[model samples]
Target: MPAFKQTQRVHDDAFDPSDSASAHLYISFGAHRIRMGVLDAQRNKFVALEDYEVERPSTVENAISFLQTQSVSNPLLQERKWQQVRIGVKNQQFTLIPEALFDLNAREEYLRLNAVVEPEHEMVHHHEHPRLELINVFTLPAALHEWSVPQFKNSPVEFVHQTSALMEGMLHMAERSARPHLFIYVDKNYVTLVVLQGLKLEFCNSFFFTSSEDFIYYVLFVLQEKKMNPDQDAVTVWGELLLDSELHEILRTYIRHVQFGKKPTGVGFSYRFDALFNHRNFDLYSLHFCD
Candidate 1:
């Protein structure tokens, strides 16, 4: 299958060539898709958004190829003199550790203890959450890491785990509410579940599923294991799901209080995006919160 790219040039006119210095570049890569957003730094609002569906080999080479094409074809990327660049990776084998006991040198062992398979080319990265007193440790393919370095060599680029960005985004959302919330970020065949008990993370894990039954089973299983009542607790879902979709239908059947998650209220988006659903591209948009 050939890769299909969809771009929404909402604020193309907003990109002022003279003010290119006040631009920030954000890119996110997952198993099934690649998404990039360009923001006007001064205005703090997104000016452009691009999404690419992975149909061919979902390899680093294919992803970089798509990115290179975008860099050339997308006027924003080619013309803008971005001041900052941020990349988010949605790879598996990410786990959280208590910040107090985090050891940089022992990341491999920690992952091993958690049953993460060691890859030949791997790099360990951690995101520290001071408020939660937790550190998220994850592995990224060396190929992807090496490929990204030279692409943004002109600027200091920050690499963040997609889950970490999701956590940060969810924490921001949790701040407004006092109740416990279950956040499910759905991808192609996997879902990242994060349980929040009043702004404090209680449980975070990723589960892979092949069928709708498997998906609902894992969600319910996590709820049961966490001692959360489906009837009483709230579940907010985001990403790659439609209201008429089977996944949504199954979830509604079991969970009494399930709703689509909203876009991060902390950031601003162009008015052109008003027609788009707030729940779509939750993780990709959440990359804005990564620091």
Candidate 2:
């Protein structure tokens, strides 16, 4: 297993490790990276953020072992007991069902329509979206469950899919505006598109692409299929995109009102975070809104 390399670490000057009892911990697990942040619930502010990158492991056991070994020396993942803990699993193996028709016993069946679920190796979980009136059925590697349960035994923990956080973040943004909006979240090779008309969720799906052309094609295709005018409907984006990059240029050429999303509202961040792009880590930051 390749080592986990530290990529970014930023913390406020007032951060105190001993004060974790009043803070909330948010962690996101992804294919290539793992990110965690600490939020002071009393102040409604984030005090620390850390990101790590690891070479892709060949198998599931290697991935769990790599994290286990790294957690031994990492203070953040150690003995601290937080006020609350939330974990976000990022992947395409998720599907949404109407809350009215959802069945807890059929979680695997609901997810099987879109993904190949191996119950022996994974645990199926569901998150209810009261605002959207839907239930998100997803899977987390069983190894992850085994590893995290004992690590945070002192604190209460809840698990959610990354899309749930993104949707909640987007819906919160829509509440401030009455107009129809299309939100796009881009990753290295996958893009999640969400459409909202005022506060209603009209569309949500993730697409995999290999090139810039493929990325733009899916974005435009979704707009056309939804009868949204590329020149009129506003499109907000979040993730690893540069203002002068090829993807941004392509987006601007095809869409008139393309803008990057902002960091979550209703929560504050330290001034040290000003150097980071507001759009970058939107999903990780939005985990605060999941519960």
Compare the candidates by TM-score and give the number of the best one.
2
lDDT of 1: 0.79
Counting only residues 3 or more apart in sequence or on different chains, how many pairs clash (N, Cα, C under 3 Å) in candidate 1? 0
Model 1, 138-256: lDDT tens per residue? 88767677766776666667778888889888888885456667899998888999989887888888888899999999999889988889999989999889999999999999999
Lowest summed lDDT across 10 adjacent residues in model 1 is found at: 1-10
TM-score of 2: 0.95
Off by over 4 Å in 1: 7-9, 16-20, 79-81, 115-120, 175-179
User: Which ten residues in a row are the worst by lDDT in model 2?
Assistant: 55-64
lDDT of 2 by residue, 58-106 (tens): 4556656756876787667774598998999988999999999999999
Pairs in clash, predicted candidate 1: none
Q: How many clashing residue pairs appear in each of the predictions shown?
A: 0, 0
